[model samples]
Target: MAAAARLAWVDATSGVAGDMLLGALIDAGASLPAIRAAVESVIPAAVALSVDEVSRAGLRAARLRVEPLIESPPHRTWRSIRALIEDAELPEPVRDRALAVFGRLAQAEGRVHGVSADEVHFHEVGAWDSIADVVGVCAALHSLGISRLSASAVALGSGRVRTAHGEIPVPVPAVLELSAGWQVVSGGAGELATPTGLALVTALASECGALPPMSLESTGVGAGTRDTPGRPNVVRVVVGTPVAEGGRDELVLEANVDDLDPRLWPGVLAALLAEGASDAWLVPILMKKGRPAHTLCVLAPVERAAALREAMFRETSTIGVRETAVRKTALERTWVHVPLLGATVPVKVAHRDGEILQATPEFDDVAALARKLGMPVRTVLEAAVAAAVDQHLIPGAELP
Candidate 1:
């Protein structure tokens, strides 16, 4: 059996920064030496990383500092940074995640400055320390084997911060652009969430909410530079195995349409799914004055509700959408390949509490194999089911 997937829930209630997140991951048991090596592989001899036990408010936390070894780090364009990361000798997953974070930053900066992403020159983020922080965070996540990442609503501070461009208001344009779909609030004064930090969360985190249900394993507190008296200037990361029985928080968006053509419903449903709806369907109903209509219902994660709602408006003629919070409980699912009729057919297994509840062959795969073998689709499906049963994939059986 495959190992259970681990979840990392980032508590950024105080605030989040790249360095702070990296520190939290390190304190949570990620190898500092591995992170250092990954960063050095990309930007060799440019910076050094070190961590110290520090106090934030009354709480003890890890503070990671990136010290630049060079006199002056060059302000690099997005193109240059992309080349450096792409050419580096690093693990595939780590390299891919690092590139994603930087890509988000580049796009945000480009949109804010009215320039193309490739031509955008990073200022504060172009420094060696910032690069080290981004790469180190990705490396740490890879080292810790974090399969799923979620975060709480981010705290974007108030007031103004001086930047290479000028003194800008807190939650700068780039940060605001990146935070479009996610929730945010002003947790304190001054700039609490930097652009790099926002990019890390928005680009990498799959969902945003309060702490999720998990079997607690370890907690790491990463301290920022300030040690405020009343509030802890830190980001906390809780790592654990997800609770299978717990239901995930979700939202339902409904829209009633009476005038749309029946042929368009298919396209609208497809568009909603593309916009992040987990499941979307239509229910036929009779409306006022005996008018027939279809009620469109969409299921979506909380973080994706906004975009999916907008998609509904754009794709359909509905002027308003109603939303309701919901809880979704799902069985653990996995896929296995079964040999049938000289072809491999994939079977989806759904299980609960270590017992398989159902095993279904992928119809599309069965049909494709049938076409290739010049056999009936029904025959191919039966063979596939027989193959799965032969492999002990059935109800009440132990999950493979």
Candidate 2:
């Protein structure tokens, strides 16, 4: 089985172009020789694939330049594009990947032009060079062993773009239609997004929102050609392992109880956390009878539903607590060994978009210390985290 891989799109806060993205990916560690071979394998021998190091927005990036294969347009129909991918002597997997990206593009174009998928023609992306870029990306990813892809909101520019159909409104109907449900933002008032880019992203990217928190292993910076102010003219592709194990929708147990002792809240929460609940908390509330109450909420993973209910009954004096399964997207997480305060303790790591966003020392680690030193577990955990941060042993944010 292939390793689980994820691709996250960086905001490009400034802008992104084809060459820039290719460059950025190369910079992030996509093998240049492999990328070149992938492109060569798909295109006619006449087309030259040129990749050179170039600086954009004061950052060095690999610039991918594709020499045009034909002086005139292919005017390639969807069928022809599909056939080219099918007929190409590329590997079966590569051909299948190419067809998938093209198929998605065709569907988006069909939607934009109010035609059936079979009737839409890819005027811009059907160009020979475009084919190389799209196919090369797929091939590079396959070579990198990546199977999953995602992006931050895509930096799709706003303004007019001159195409075969003359000047059309910015974002081009096809790109806009394809990027549905994905976060897309305007940048530098240029044509930052291409139909091929949108289609590739929409088809390959598994998630289209913010970079999910992740422990970043490496990053690839793909450089675009345009020089825009205030934003890096490159796309940052992040690759890393997802930390999440399997999780399911949870029941949120909530109840407002005015008569319970406030001191019981802490123990209740701890018990819930110990009983497999994902998270537990309390909020101050004013009941209808004008009595002050604490609204306790418990978010329990599916398997712990009964345990959470039993705890509520045992800990709180409420006759009933509302319960319902609520779906949530959470980062895959794991624990790592980090030395802090003269000891190596396990630290919890959370990731999204392939970057480590949060790292906290395990409470059990602190509790162990507390037992050894006769101190509170919270104090030990906090001090250990602080020491880890002060010594630059742990990442940002102390234990919470």
Best by TM-score: 1
The C-alpha TM-scores of every prediction are 0.68, 0.58
**What count of clashes does model 2 give?**
31
List clashing residue pairs in candidate 1: none
- 79-165, model 2: which lDDT tens digit per residue? 887767666667544565567567767767877778866678778777777787777776666566664555667778887989988
What does candidate 1's lDDT look like per residue over 27-101, in tens digits? 999999999999999899999899999998899999998988889899999889988988999887677677767
Enumerate clash totals for all models, in the order shown: 0, 31
Badly placed stretches (over 4 Å) of model 1 are: 1-4, 246-400
Query: RMSD in angstroms, candidate 1?
Result: 7.9
lDDT of 2: 0.68
